[model samples]
Target chain A: MATPVLTVKGLTKNFGKLCAVNQINLQVNQGEVFGMLGPNGSGKTTTLGMLMGVVNPTAGEFSWFGQPPTHHIRKKIGAVLEHPIFYPYLSGQKNLELNATIKQTDFNNIAKVLDIVELTARRNDAYKTYSLGMKQRLAIASALLNDPTVLILDEPTNGLDPMGIAEIRTIIKRIAADGKTIILASHLLDEVQKVCTHFAILRKGNLVHSGPVDDVGKGEEIVEVIAFHDDLPAHLNQFQGTKEVKKDGQFYLVKMNNGFHSAELNRFLFEKGIVVSHLATQKKSLEKQFLEILAENNTH
Target chain B: MLHLLKIDLKKLTSYRTFWVVCGLYFITLGFTTASGMEFLKWLANKSVEFGATININRIPLYHFPDIWQNVIFVSGFFKLILAFMVVISVTNEFTYRTIRQNIIDGMSRTEFLLSKMLTNVLLSLLSCAMLLIIILITGFIYSPEIIWSEIFTDAGFMFAYFLEMFSFLSYTLMLGLLIQRSGLTIVVLCLSHMLEAIIKANIDDVTPGLIPFFPMESITNLVEMPFARYAFQEIQDYVSLTSVAIALGWLVIFNYISYLKLKKSDL
Candidate 1:
């Protein structure tokens, strides 16, 4: 495997008496869209802030590209923490120019990045005059100015309209498709599950669960069926490749082995003289898994 | 360092209030110097007798060695106008949160503090150069035959004026750092005058000789009042070395506070 683009070990931060971030260890490798998922106040922002060098870590250490944390190292990485940070007086192009200057990058790329964000037309408008979505777009555009290999975004879609959120997600996914390592922190589990290739769940500054997004709830293709009559799901285990079956209030959750699918199950149920009224092949959503992870961690 | 200042200048040049206040400072410098010269010319015409028959123009107020003190002392009053620019520049980063953005963009805390100090130095140099040109034109316009040798006589006051600006900027920067809002910072700055007065009154009441040693007071004392000499009143004849040292000391302290705050605090 390639070297980890970001290696955070025992990263913790405390705001006086409140431990904003406890010991959290995480590693994000190159070209992987790694999402830090948690609910509000779960320290997702603080962890991202500490990684971006905005909030000083009370304990532990982190590094970018195997080098110590320094301005030079930071120049290689692009990030936007909790808020959309820009001088509102400047034009969109001017704000990106400022970012380019800070990174010691070329000003020529400002046009290209503006185009990427679909903000080339509004490039001359002052940042204050832009809408809220435009401001967030501008922030992401600035983060892309240096053509950084690693992008860190904290709640990129927070407070954005649906259109704005879709636009940002498209841009982010495009960048990720281009083989850039993206470290995103969000409370939206669906967003993370959709955009990220790997994920880590944070609860009160602790890593509850983390792995490949595809690895979540693997080895089971559960199907939920609702029928007009009762006593039909009790014989579901008699079907071939059935692992387990359970019923919960007007729905039957059939845990099937790898060989069975919803179509096969429907045909067998029909052959068994049972008529199906509703059948939905259950796709285990990250939201359910995330809440389960949080609930389990809470009990411990 | 130049790159860091370039990073700062990129933002500063785009900042409107920076240029507005800067324009105000130079304009005020020109208007005040011209008005001072014009008023002195008016006094020369009025032939107003201060005691009995002495004309104000005959008092050598615009002469070479004396012109330095007169110009610098008046120009120093306009430091507030320029100091407000510094206040805005520093607070702009905080209010807009560009400082945190800049830090995330690749500027370290020390580089951030240094960029501001460098801008303060740049402003000091620019303002002092403008002051020099104004003094030269006004002095040559009103005074007798130029004695090239006496040009450097009161030049120390000119240097003192630059230090005074640099140090005052440091103080204003500290205020900006401590209070992040522009409107609030300005209010606190204005209120600080009375605040300083109260503190200095209480402190100086116990130690009689320490009032001149105050931070802002020492900066203001760098160039003694030149217009007051027109009233036939006594002033600090020479630039007080003690005051300059104290002002420089305060400058170091203010910058230290700014750096420490930026370094230690989570932006």
Candidate 2:
């Protein structure tokens, strides 16, 4: 197995008597896009802040490429936490240049980063002149100026329009494809499910669930079948291995037992002379798993 | 360190408010010098009317020079303005959440503190140089017999003044770190200066000697002459080297406290 690009073990942080981030362990392997899913004030920002060394961890330790939080390790990590704070009066290129200087990066990368963010046309514009989405892109460009081994972003698409979101998503996906480990912290579960291969769910400063996204809601295949008639729910249970059947107007929602296939159920229904208007098979979304985890925590 | 200093300079230079303040300083100095030269002319005329031996040759001695005196006088004004500017320079990083970014960008707390100190020192030196150039030009144009000795003496005064300014800026930087707001620190410094002035007014015997130890007093004494000449038999007795030492001591104490606070505080 390839070495993990980032390793966070038993990370904990406190703001006075209040624990803002409980003991949590996470890892992002080389070239993997890992998502940190959470709601507002769920300690997602705090955890990222600690990883970037902006916030001091009250307990536990983290290592990047098996090295501690030294300058050498930080040089290989790029991050955008919450909002991007730059010199508002300076041009975007100037701001990126300053960051590049601090990281001892090549000056030539400034233009390349601007091109990557599609901000090459507005690189000379002052930061205050840019729109919110443009500012966010510039912020990402600053992070990417060093061509870091790992990229950590906090809500990379928070205030972006759909078009802008697509643009940024494509950029992130491309970066990850280029063999850079990416850690995305966001409240948008759909985006996480679409872009990340691995995920960690945090709630109220605690890590509730974490692992491969494919393994989140294991052992079941959920299929939604819509029929032309509203009485289709009455006959839905005839399908073998059907765990539950629920009626939603003209549709019957079916969840099959572990190892059951949607094709087998469709074939069985067709053989029984029941016409299926619509049959769709899908893994449970990250949203469903996330809500389930939060609900479970509340119950406990 | 040089990279950090360059970033600091770039930030300070980019601020529109900095240029606005500089423009105001130049305009105010111009008005002050014109008015001061008029007053000197009036004094010369009055002396002639009173039948005093007011020779044209000695008029330069009585009047000093144009704008040179204004330049020295403006040091007090610039000291106050620059002190406030220095406070904002350090505090804004905390107020605007840039300090977190700076640290995340790989700067240690010590590096951050040292960068501010170095920036303030460089700016103070730049201000001193501008004031000196203004004085020399004004003095040469208005009075050919300008005393270079007085300029050297003024330089000495400003050296002491720079130390006092350094002390106040360092103390304000610490106060900014502790309070985490530029406005609050300014208010506190303003109120403290006023309170100290009131205290000095009521207790002249001891306050003049003691006030020099406070941050503001040290700055005031550094920019302006000490008033102890009127109350004491010898000027040297009142303006001891201890005052300068005390000012330096304040810088050390405040910087140490700021470092400790920065190391322990949560970002």
In terms of docking quality, model 1 is medium
- Model 1, stretches more than 4 Å misplaced? A219-221, A226-230, A236-250, A255-280, B41-52, B227-234
* TM-score for each of the candidates: 0.92, 0.85
The candidate scoring highest on DockQ is: 1
| Model 1 lDDT tens row, B107-221 | 8889889988999989999988998888888788877879899877888887898899999988999999998888888888777778888999788768969898788788888
The TM-scores that each candidate's chain B achieves against the reference are: 0.92, 0.75
lDDT tens digits, residue span B1-267, model 2 = 787787677667777877776667656654564444466567778777633554344344222332333345445555556667777777778777878877777677777788888887876676666656656655666665657655444345546646765777787778788888888888986686888778877777754667666666665554444333334433332224766777677778889998999888778
Question: TM-score (0 to 1) for chain A, all models?
Answer: 0.90, 0.92
Q: Per-prediction DockQ scores?
A: 0.74, 0.47
Best by TM-score: 1
- Supply candidate 1's per-residue lDDT for A230: 63
lDDT for residue B54 in candidate 2, whole number 0-100: 44
Model 1 DockQ, alpha carbons vs. true complex: 0.74
